[model samples]
Target: MTDEPQRAGRRTRLYALTDGRTAAPHTVLTMDTTITAAVDAHDGLPSEWRAVLAMCPAPNGRAVAEIAARMRMRLTPMALLLGELADRGLIHHRPPLEGAETTNVHLLMRIRDNLARI
Candidate 1:
């Protein structure tokens, strides 16, 4: 997201902490790893990213591009993060509409190009 691999690495670590655990059955902590991770992710989220996610998975569960502008976030990184969230199953990714994927890519590229100028 920041033109560096380390941010992505850190994001992966953050996702591991915040996702994939259920409190059902109320079992004891099998590992302290999860707790630590959650704390880490919660503390590390970029203010912008955190703010974006706070308003995400929109009321209608719209596509990433649709939400990006509203959040004033760059499209490429937001797309990457959406993929990450979906991969983690923290959020659901609806299969694109018949041609939504194509249109989505076009929009993202356009946004990326436009932002590059600034």
Candidate 2:
């Protein structure tokens, strides 16, 4: 039988690899963010994170969803791992592009006006 720490370590490793599907399916990873070589060299980095960094092409990096899918990990854990990497300055988490979140209020108003004109 394995010791408690060993069992916990195994669990972590398993969690790091498998997608338990507990997180929101729509959880979006910042597509524009880039992980760096520093992350690759960081000895303290978790294997799951390191795997993500390795999979990332750098400069262009990848979407959070893409990275999570590639890594076969859950969305929340992937986000947390990316946050950890950013905290360590081993990666850059670029916020979603401005104006990308424009609401449809303008469209709705235009539609309402057009309907009134009918």
Candidate 3:
């Protein structure tokens, strides 16, 4: 049987996961972080990493947030997976233009309070 149904189901799940409101969008996946496939071809990647690698645009690469959105995965877990792939030399992950920043609890709390007000 074709894997079409399985692929479609996966896409559906990704959509559902990404549709909900999240507290720290910036923390998970941000526009500036770029992701590129390090290998020439999909040879020995884990299935999940394969899916992530597939989502990355060739040559130009893709933003981390875009991948997370397409994959319908939470940014935190996605970040971990990406990190693993990068460590394996299967993918390249570039920090955002401004460089990575440590999480500031005060800032997050402020954003959360503001969002709650809306």
Best by TM-score: 3
Ranked by lDDT, top first: 3, 2, 1
* Candidate 1, 65-86: lDDT as tens digits: 5445554446654555455444
Candidate 2 has which clashing residue pairs, if any? 29-64
lDDT score for residue 13 of model 2: 48
Displacement of residue 108 (Cα, Å) in model 3 is 24
lDDT of 2 by residue, 1-118 (tens): 2101111243354445333433333333454443444445344755655566665645655556556656556766777666655655566555553564436678558646743543
Off by over 4 Å in 3: 1-31, 41-43, 98-118
Candidate 2 TM-score versus the reference: 0.49
TM-score, one value per model: 0.37, 0.49, 0.53
Between candidates 2 and 3, name the one with more favorable lDDT: 3
CA RMSD (A), model 3 = 11.7
Better of 1 and 3 by TM-score: 3
Stretches of model 1 off by over 4 angstroms after superposition: 1-59, 99-118
Give the winner by lDDT: 1 or 3: 3
lDDT of 3: 0.56
| Candidate numbers, best TM-score first, in rank order | 3, 2, 1
